[model samples]
Target: MDVWPSLREAAARVDDLVAALPAPGARSAAQRAELGTARDAARTLRVRYLDAHAEMLYERLTAGTQGLRLEELVEAAGAGYPSVVPTAAQLESDRGRRQADKEGHEIDQGIFLSAVLRSPSAGPHLLDTMLRPTPRALELLPEFTRTGVLRTRSVLLERRDGAAYLTLCRDDCLNAEDEAQVDDMETAVDLALLDPRVEVGVVRGGEMSHPRYRGRRVFSAGINLKCLEAGDITLTGFLLRRELGYIHKLVRGVLTDRPGSWHSRTVEKPWIAAVDTFAIGGGAQLLLVFDHVLAAADAYVSLPAAREGIVPGAANFRLGRHTGPRISRQVILHGRRIHAAEPDARLVLDEVVEPGAMDAAIAAAVERLRSPAVVANRRMLNTAEESQDEFRRYMSEFALQQALRLYGEDVIAKAGRFAGRSG
Candidate 1:
């Protein structure tokens, strides 16, 4: 569909300005300065263009969700870090990136997501699509129910008698999230919710292979810093996808377009999080949505967003509900670590167990929350606590906040340093 004439003009201008700017590399000192100036000019033009043309841009883009889902279209429009460069190709030399250039483009797409998520007409449809069970999950669900286990790149889904366990399986990185893990994790989540026999859901960490913690289960270390250093993580793909995808599904559940599904309620399951050694950053954010949490005595959790110079997913809005405002501030901004056994951490960790007994404790906790009322109560709880409107508002703002941080000079410099140390 053709867009408004003004919007088309603005978009054309945007393209011309972007085409004039140099690509990511700037070799000489003079070239670096020139690159910075050109990029700044592009940003100025884009933001002003957005201010003048956001609505038409949104309408023009969303008009095609019939062909591409809103999520898919944003990705098609360059919403994240550049696609993964092959390992051998990357070994040659430094990328020398001062900031995430893709983010300048992602800013516009991010705003579209934020806008769609909050629009009364678009929001509901976006929610349905965003929370829809992934294509992979749909493909694997039938086999999953019969076999009782479903595995993905970053998650292990095991269906016991009544509970479906969604275990993070990125053990090589201590269950840290990376670019590929989002879909894997979300697909596993979809199966758990759709499985006819699953009464409740449980998420825990798989055993780690790191020499220091070999064979020991370690709940997530959050976003993979190694991947970040490698420039693999992106604003839309890794960051916003988690918020709108699996994490949201953990609380809001999945919806589908099957016959009668519109009248049928969302297929939500009450979830239990079993924190083993620790839940850091993204891991800690997961805790906020679970109906119950079981943590080992030695387990700790933290959201080191301030230290990492990025937003901590939904923690800024949701952690306060668990830890209260003061402690939430400490956790998000002051880099405070809250061990499972601590008093301040009590609210987030429902029950603490001995490290070796996490499995048994999780089973018991699942049984306790396994009644048919669990999902119903979860919906009720969400209504009173973190309503849809509230979540929508936070995410809408977060979409842009996170994109800014992903491209911040400090964050880029930090990633380069981390890469330097590792290399």
Candidate 2:
């Protein structure tokens, strides 16, 4: 008369049956046929039970017919499943294959529709977030392990001036809960990129609002370099770690090592540039690697190695090479952030516009670079810059300096500053 235990057993059997279907070759003939029957029953249950069909079907299958055995289904599904899960290496290799075969896409049909219906006013932040990462955006990406999402978004629009623009937005997140949920918005973005509706490789940042990273956990500023390092093992860490290899491949894909490719040219891709509200420490380092820099006139750009009792890493190398060693040393040693009055003559931006004018400036620059000839000329100039061995030496020296600085008394002093801090 106690049906509860019987139902539980039946559910177990059903789960096994479904799980075993992936490797049907391992099943006995009778078990295979039984699985087919159970599957059919599941289909029927789907239509009949509607709301609780899955649970009902699972119970029915696990019940194991002594002859054909509802219990056998559960046993079969469980037995055929692998014990060891795929490793991060395996998953990454698989993910890369999938990504290379397709393109990153954005899922914005709903957002787009909402924006259209709502007639939302687009601000520069919104536009920047929505814009895709251009080719050669970053030379290196770090790798992390955790549940993650890789998303790409792109939008094409014609300016009123008759110029066509392609925006590639790329944003990724990891450690998301509920993998099966419809709201893994990155999946939608990936679908868009893979679809032939637009040029492949175009990407945009994925959904900015997901329950996991939304509301009470909005991105707060004051996340300085050390805090950034701590969070490397967090969501941002996973995103960076997972995509590091992909970033490398992308750079190699576009800038071949072979002669006469973009890598070998004296200039670089004309439209390649970086514009951001804040590029501090590593962020600033990465941006300086760009051929063109656009910063909000008020955007704080700093290499605060001295402030942190450490040496700047890549930023020191890149900026020092871009400017002379003396200027780079002064900036890094003094923790000199760029003030509003600085000139851009030292291999920085051609001009730094007022905060509101940045978007316009970037748009104008992109328009100019759309020309193939201009891009080619820029590549030649950049290639000339790249050929300087002194710059390469600088990066090497900077790396060494950073490693040494981490152990210095300065680092201890800096650590003292953060000892009692709370977010």
Candidate 3:
């Protein structure tokens, strides 16, 4: 069959099904499963069509927003959901809900995200906008001295002993990454880097509530797959936002408007990751970016996003630096887990402490990382490892690739399986 006709038909099926579904809320478990299958086909066609006409659509969508900074560009799109979205998405309730929910419109957002990065002028402008602290960060900065604690929905930042303890607090899902965590983590990191009292930053996960790992601190379980199943994780809100947001800030340091490259004139600090039980998928990706890592003796790390049909953040780009190409491929492609105290994790783990000794380990690690040369050499090492331009290029492609993977059949199927097993 011809591509246009098939694409149109596929989209029609989704619209028809969505219109017929109950409006009180989302579909039932079974209905959602049905929708999942249909959405997969529809997304595949739409993504292909979008890719084919990316240039034409990109020019029109970004015309008014051209030359605008990243923050300004989104505001220009619209106050909220309507702006930057396609006519087709605008005409439907699901589209409106998706935009409102901050989980839909990945196809357009993907293209727009890529266009912004690929543009010669807007690229740096976009990077500058994202690399800086969020407005929330500024708001919380004042409170830092009062409590030396800045708390967000999914993250907690505490300033003490000259170290900013940046704790990931999502015990409900073993500290998995969701949109909320992504936003809050960025804010916390900003507060840490901004604080004059903080000489170093320490990242570690909170205690888990799940019975299987009850009370144990898990580094992270990666993207909230259950949320992924519910279609809650969005390309713009989570995936793309993260690579450029906190994760980059963690590696690049919090940036502000300056005359020179973002790398220089920095407020950056060395960070140490205290890996607890495990750092799976996105968690594992985080290990590659830290200046130092202290993994629990029993802790292990793995990149299993590919198994779920999703990109595991920047792990693909930076893992090779820590684990070589062969090891990176094994972990990323084959879902290999590198346990601490083993040869595989030796390069990544600065030290592997017993689970009970984590606090002492972190305290010592903080002091070692606070050496003046650390702050002095952080920017140099980060730039040498992955320059802003190199990252921009990676993100330019990742925007499109991850958008498709986020909505792929395999992702949906795996999410369903996870939900079922949990249920």
Candidate 4:
């Protein structure tokens, strides 16, 4: 029997079937399922062909290196839909089966290669060939990226069970400048809150500054607003921008003049804001204005501004009202990190999650806040006799002092030391 002609005919039949299916966006459930089966078959056929051609074209394809750095190409590929990613055991078992099936072939390249063909480059080319993301998985990507600087190069993605998933780049170790990028990122999140479509907002943990720690460069301890600056005093001047001034006006628009914008509401969409991973120092304080707080089980939320020889900006007054005199005194006086379990803790973190459980925690928190019962009656009860007056005073001083404190030599040095990135 002429096997080559038979193989070529079979390959042509498979390609025809693949081409006739509806596009990813339009595929019906049954069509999608059939496509999945066909894709698996096509992948196997590809590996068989490649192995057959290897004797003549192998070196050219691999460029003198080990079998075409498939792993590197997979690393570069963009996200697909989130599927139920298999555990290591499942992948191992699947690989074994493929290897056994290919053992009788002329050359057994590997089962992994037979299972999928991840493109060496990323773009529409890959999307057309690979399985499409489930609608839910596609929804998460834009929501996650809309609020911060998700370095496209660092996005980690996986696909399984007809879905796609994404996480920060695996090698996403933070440097000082990266942390500074987060500060700008949070500001972007704050701006996005003005949009009604957004239900939750976040700026994931990242390096704020690049300073030499003991001996190596590291991300600094707090949000680094330095990147927004143009000159020596530029970061200090960021607050004076009309855009920032608009934030102030928006807050003032609702609650005349409230310290930290706490107890204020915008005419825009309602939202539940959250921060994870070392939401202390400036990071913690910045979040104080949010309507709700969701933290990680291991998250360290605090305010250490006082340790640098300054009070807790307007946070002292706003947070004092939120948690009362005792807890506020503890935070302001000691300049300590507030673990989620502290009694009468300021900001009253609504929920806590274990390390790596931020997504689940965020989902639960957002879902709860979306309920009419939760959003209508805020948990706070104001008691200060001169609440409005005091809040106004604090906002004014907060503006002036925050400007000075952020750029002060002492604060910068402390931030550098904390981030392990020396200024």
The models' CA-based lDDT, in order, is: 0.73, 0.35, 0.75, 0.39
Which candidate gets the maximum TM-score versus the true structure? Answer: 1
For model 3, what is the alpha-carbon lDDT of residue 185? 89
Please say which candidate is ahead in TM-score: 1 or 4.
Answer: 1
Runs in model 3 with CA error above 4 Å? 1-75, 78-92, 95-104, 257-263
Write out the backbone clash pairs for model 1. Answer: none
Clashes of each: 0, 50, 1, 23
- The ten-residue window of minimal lDDT in model 1 covers 80-89
Q: Per-residue lDDT for 1-423 in model 4, tens only?
A: 323454455545544654586544466779767755654554455445544542233233334432222222222211110011112332333233321121111111122222222222211122121112212223454654444323333232322121112222212333222322333332333333333344443334432222322222111243332332212212112231211222232122211122454644332223343444556544455455555566666556777666654444356766665677887777777876677656544355766666567667656655555655533343222212323344444443443345445545565555445445334
Best by lDDT: 3
In model 1, what is the error at residue 5, expressed in angstroms?
7.4
- Arrange candidates, best lDDT first: 3, 1, 4, 2
Tens digits of lDDT, candidate 2, 244-360: 112211121232223554544211232233333445554455445443556556555666667766544445545766778877776788866665346733355555677667557
Which whole-number lDDT from 0 to 100 does residue 47 have in model 2?
25
Could you estimate the TM-score for every candidate? 0.85, 0.41, 0.80, 0.44
lDDT of 2 at 113: 16
The deviation in Å at residue 313 for candidate 4 is 3.7
TM-score ranking of the models: 1, 3, 4, 2
lDDT for each residue of candidate 3 in 166-226, tens digit (9 for 90 to 100)? 8888887888898889889888888888887899999999988887888889989888877
